[model samples]
Target: MLSLLPQRILRLLEFIGFSGNRRFGLSQLREGASNHSLRSILCAFTLLFYNTYVSLILGTGEGNLAEAEALLEPYQEKYPKGSIILFYSARITSLRGNLEKARARYEECISSQQEWKQIHHLCYWELMWNHSFQQEWQQAYRYADLLCRESRWSKAIYVYQKAAILSMMSAEELERTGEDLGALFRQVEGLKQRLAGKSIPMEKFAVRKSRRYKASNPVPLVIPALEMMYVWNGFSIVGKRADLTESLLVTIEKVEQQLQNDPNPTEYHPDDSCLVQMLKGLCLKYLGRFLQAELCFSEVLSSEGRIRYDHYLVPFTLYELGLLQKQQGDFIKATTYIERAKTNYKDYSMESRLHFRIHAALNSLKGSPVSTP
Candidate 1:
C-alpha cells in the first residue's frame, strides 16, 4: 500500500525516513496469496483490490484484470456463493465492461447473505454506477438513495450523488419523483465529516459545488452525475461500450444546447460550458472521433481564463487530453501534457487523485506492464 502512494507523497515520506518497494511488496502479497494459509484469502483480496480498483481509479486504467481473475478463480470455486467473492467477481466483470453481467452478479452478491449489510451497501454503490453507465437514471437513483439512507460510509458523497443523479432526470420525471433538487444539494455540506484530522477531498469538492444550490434562485448543476462519473473514471469503463459512450455524448450535447440557450447566464456559465466540453471530449475520444475530441479538449483549455469556480477543470482536462494523445500513439506529446497537468497545477479539487493518475501514466510511458492479455 505504501508503495502505491503517489510519487510526490512518496517523496514526502522519504524525507521522513520512510520508503517502499513496489515490486517487493507485490511479491510478498503474491506469495501469501499462493500459500494455503489462514490469511490466504486476505492476501488474495489485497492483490485483487490493487489490481481491480486501485489501478483503475488512481492509475491509467491499466489494471491487470487477468491476474485478478486468476487469483479469484480457485477461491470462487471453493466458495461459489461467498458474498465477498461474488462482490469482487462482479467488480472484475464491471471493469471488463460487462455491465449487465456485473449488475446481475452484484444483485446475487447482495442476496447471497444478510449477515453483513455492509457487503450489500457495496453492491448498492456498484449497482448505482452500473445503472448510471447505461443512463438508467431512475434505477441509478434508487441505489444512490439506498446508500444515502442506510450506508454509514460518506453520507455527504451519497447525498450529493443522489442529488446529482436527480439532476440528470427530465423535468417531468424529476417533478414526478417530487424531489427538491436544490434542497438535496443544500444537504451535502451539513452531512460532511472529517476523517483522520483531514477533510475528505471529494466531500470538500461536493460541498464547494453545493454552494450553488444555497442561493434563493439556484443555478442547477449541468449533468452533475455525469460529472461525478468523470471524477470516478466511469468514462473509461463506459467507453468500452460504444452504445453507452454515444448515448453519453447525446446527453452531453443536449445539455450543451440548453446551456447555450440560457438567456440569463451566470458567472458559472463559462465553467459549466468547459465542463461539458471536457466530458464531450472524453465521449468523442472513446467513439473514435479523434479530430473532434481533440477540438473539444482544446476548446476547454482555450476558455481557461473565463472559468471562475472550477479551476480544477483546466488541469484535469489537460490530463484527459494527454490520455487522448496517448491513445493515438503520440507518447512524447502525451507525456508533455500529462507532466504539465502534474507539475503546473496545485490546490485543485482532487489534486491528489490526478497526481496518482499522472504517476501511473508516467510509469506506463516508461513501459510498465500494467495490463494483462
Candidate 2:
C-alpha cells in the first residue's frame, strides 16, 4: 500500500491546482490520523506529504506559484524516496516553460513506474507532451504505440490524433515525410468496430432522455435540433453542405422560436445555449447576415461564466468570431479570437470537422500558417 502511495499522491496533485493543496492535505491528514494508532505517526506524515504534493500539482490559480513551490519543498526534504513528487514538480516547471527539466522528470517517472499499467497513461501523456513541444512526430508515434499496447485507449487515440495534427502542421513536412493521411481514418474505423459490439449509442437527446429518470426534465426538442447542426457542420466539412443546408436552416429557425417561447427553456443550460448560439451564428454566417452572426458569437463570448467544459461550442464560437472579424478586415481583433480558439483547442478532446474551417481562416491571417496534409 505504501508503494501505491505515490500514485494516489499524484492523482491528488492533479486536482490541487484547481482546488487548494493545503486544504486537501489537511483533509487527508485528518482521515489517516483518525484511522491509525499513535505509533503510525510516520505513516500519517507520509500520507500528509503525499496529499500536499498532490495539491501543489493540481492548484493553478493566479499568483499561486510560490505557494505551490513552498508546499513541495518540505516533501523533497522529508521523503527523498518519493520520486513521484519530482514528476509533479517537473509538471510545474513545464508550465513555467522549463521544457528540459520537465522532460527529465517525465523520463524519471517512466523509469520508476515501468511495471504499473495505470501509471503508463501518465507516462504516455508526458512523452506526448515532450514530443509535441519538440515537434518530434516519430517519437510521439512510438510513445503512442506503446500506450495503445499498454491498453491506454483514450491516450492512444489522442496520440494518433496528434500525429495527424503534426502532419497537418506543415505542408513541407507532410510532403517530405510521405505520411499516410488515412491513418486517422483507419484508427477511427478500428475504434468504431471495437466499440460496435458494445451498445454505446451516440449521445443524442433521445438516448440521454431514455437513460435519465422519468421526472428528470426530458430533453427539449431544440437540443436535438442543435445536435443536428453539429451534424450539418460535419457534412459541410466533407463538402456535403448541400445535404445539410435545408434541414439545418429549418431546424435552426425552429430552435430559435422554441427558445423565445419557452419561459425556461433548457437552452439556458450553458452547453445547450452555447450550441444553439453557435449553430444560429453558423446559419446566419452562411446566409450572409454577417452582423447577426457576429451578435451570436458575441453573446457566447459574454456568457463565458456559464460555459460548460464538455461543449465544443465555446471554441467554435471563438473561431467563428475570428473568421467574422477577419472578413470585416479587423486583423488585430481576428487574431485575438483565433488565439483564444487555439488555446481552447488544447482542451478539446475530439477532432471535429469545424476545425478545418478555423484553420483555413487562421491561415489567411498574418503569422498564422495553415498546415496541409
Candidate 3:
C-alpha cells in the first residue's frame, strides 16, 4: 500500500528512466507486511496480487508457481478457511495444472464467503476454466452462463465465452443451453464497453469474431472455446498436462475428419479448415508431435491465398510456427518467423497478446536481440 502511486506519476517516472524496480517494490511490500499496523494486510494483499495474477498476465504463463505457493503458505496455515487465501491458493494450483485441486479450493472459497457475491464470481470464473481445460464443454458453459447472467465484471466477455463454450458442444448438448449462439453473438457488439474512450481490444476482438455469424449463411466456428483459450494464453497452463493436450488433439482430429467428409463446401470452407488446422497444430506442438504440428501450421500458410474471411489466421499461424521452431531449437528459423508475424500483422484479433508472446520468444532466443517486428 505504501508503494502505491498514481498512474500518471508512475508513467512520468518511467519516462524519465526511473523504470520499475522489482527489488524496491518487493522491499516496500515486505516492510509494510512486517509492520505492526492496520495496513499490514493490505501490503500482503498487494504482494499476493502480483504473484498470483499480475505476473501471469504480463509475462509468459510459465509463472513462478513455487514463489506464489510460498507466499500463500503462511497465510494458508494462519487463515485455514480464509476466502482470500483459498482463492490465491486455488489460482496457483490452477496455473500449475492441478485442475482437481484448484476446483476443490475454489469451491471451498465459494462456501467460505456469502456476504460478497464478487468472490463467488471469481471462483466461478476459475471453475469454468478448470472444466474447459478438462474439455467438459457443458460444465464450462454452465459457469460462463452464470457469469453472463450474474457478474458485472465484463458482460462482453462472459456472453461471448458462454456462446463459445456452447459452440464446442454437440447439437443435443447445445440445445440444453436453450440459447441461440447467433443471438448471443449479436449481443456482443452492444455489450462492448470502452476504457479511457477506446473500446477494449479484447472486446473489439470478440465483436469482430461475432461478425462471422452476422452473415445470412453463417458458417459455424470450429472449437471456439479452445480458440479463446489460445487467445487468453490458457495453452500455457494446459501444456503442463499431457492428458489435457491429448484430449484437445482428439477434439481437433474429430473436427478435421468431419470437415473432410463434408459433401457441400461453403465460401468460408478454406478459412474454417485452416483455423482447425492451426488449432490442431497447437495441440500437436504441446504433445511434442513436432513434425505433424509443423505440417499443420505449414498448411495454413500454404492456404493463405484461399482464405476469404478471418484475415488474422495467417499471422497467428506464423506466430505458432515460430514457437514450434523455437521448441525444436531452431533459433534462427524461429526468430525469422516470429519477426515476420510481429511485423506483418496489424489490427488483428488479440494483436497485443500475440506481441507479448512473440516478444517473450524473441527475447529468449540466443544471440542478437530480436528486432521490433
Candidate 4:
C-alpha cells in the first residue's frame, strides 16, 4: 500500500516510521503458502491475485504469469472444477492474450458452481472485458447488462459501463435493445455510493463522465468504452496480439477521420480528438510502430493546453510516452518522463489509477524486467 502513496507523503512516512518491505512481505506470504495450514490457501490466493491481476492493472503489464500458474497448479489438481482456480486460470490466459481460451475457461468457471452468485459476478466481469478486448460490443453489452441487473458490487459502475458499451454500438443495434443511453447515464450519479467513508475512484470517474449527459442536448461521448478500456489497462492485454492491436488502430483511425470532417465541432471536440489520438498511440505502440506512436502521443501533449475537460490526458500521455521509451530500451529518458508525470500532476480524473501505473513503471525501470508489447 505504500506504493500507492505520493512521494512526499512516502518521504514523510519514512521519517516518522520504517515502511514495510515488499520483499519481506512476499517472503512471509510464500512461507505461509508452502505450509499445510488452514490459511495456506489464503496465502496462495493473495499471491495469485497480486501476480495475476494487481501487477498487470496497477503496475506495468509484466505480471508473473509463470509464478501464478505454479501457485494454481496444486489447487487445480486438487479441485479440478474449482470456480476460483478456473477463474484464475482464465485470468492468466487472458493476461497472455488468449481471449478465446479465457472466455471458455470463464464459462466453465461459471458453470462449475451455482451456490456462489458472487463468483458468477466475477466471471461476468471477465467475460465482459474478454468480449470487449475482442471488440464484440454486442456480446460485451450482454455481459454488462447482466452485471447491471444481477451484480450488487457497484451499480454506478455497472450502469455506467452498460451505457458506455452501448455507446459503441450502431444506432440500429442500439435501437433493437430498447434501452435509453441517456437514461442509463443519468442513473449513474444517483446509484453512486460511498464505501468506508470514501468514494471509489473509478466510480467517481464514471459518475463525472456520466454528468455530461445531464445537460440538455448533451454532446455524445466519443468512444467512452474504449477510454475506460485504457483506464483499466485493457490495452496492455489486447496488445499481446498484433491482430487485436491493429484492429483497434483501424477503429480509432475511422473515428479520427469523422472527427476531423465535422464542420462545427463542439467545445469538447479537442478533448475527444486527443482521447482518440492517445488510444491510437497505444495501438500503434503495441503494433511496433513506435515512431508513429510517439507522434500520436506528442500530438496529444502539444495540444495539452486546449483539452477542456480531460486534463488527465496530458499526464497520462506523458506516462504512455515513458512506457514507449522504456520499450525502446531507453531507461534514462523513460524515468525522466514518468517522474514528470508522477510529480507534475494532481486532482485529475483517475489520478490514483495513473499514480499506481506510474509507480509500477518506475519500479519496472529500476529493476523489474518489463515485457514489450
* Candidate 4 structure, TM-score to reference: 0.95
In candidate 3, which residue pairs get closer than 3 Å at backbone N, Cα or C atoms, i.e. clash? Answer: 342-373, 343-373
lDDT of candidate 1?
A: 0.91
Candidate 2 residue lDDT tens string, 103-173: 77777766765566666567666666455444455676556556656664453244334444344234576
Task: Please give the lDDT score at residue 230 for candidate 2.
Answer: 45
- TM-scores of all candidate predictions against the true structure: 0.96, 0.39, 0.87, 0.95
lDDT of 4 by residue, 1-373 (tens): 4644555667788898857456777888889999999989999999998888787778877888888898899999999999998999999999999999999999999999999999999999999999998889999999999999999999999999999999999999999999999999999999988989999998999998898999998989999989989988899999999998888888899999999999999999999999999999999999999999999999999999899899999999999999999989877778989999998989998888788888778867876344433
Instruction: Compose the digit string of candidate 3's lDDT tens values, residues 99-169.
Output: 99999999999999799899999999989999999989888988998999899888998999999999988
Tens digit of lDDT per residue, candidate 1, span 1-373? 7766788789899899988787888899999999999878889999999998888888878888999999999989999999999999999999999999999999999999998999999999999999999999999999999999999899999999999999989899999888998889999999989989999999999999999999988888889999999999999899999999999999999999989999999989999999999999999999999999999999999998999999999999999888887888887778889999988889989998888888888867776233322
Flag the better candidate by lDDT, 2 or 4. 4
Poorly placed runs, candidate 2 (over 4 Å): 1-63, 78-81, 134-139, 153-156, 169-179, 192-311, 315-373
Which candidate tops lDDT?
1
TM-score for candidate 1, residues paired by index: 0.96
Cα RMSD (angstroms) for every candidate in the order listed: 2.7, 17.7, 4.3, 2.5
Worst 10 residues of 1 by lDDT: 364-373
Q: Which pairs of residues clash in candidate 1, taking residues 3 or more apart in a chain or in different chains?
A: none
Better of 1 and 3 by lDDT: 1
| Residue 281 miss distance in model 4 (angstroms) | 0.3
Misplaced by over 4 Å in model 3 are 1-51, 366-373
- Which TM-score value belongs to model 3? 0.87
Give lDDT for model 2: 0.52
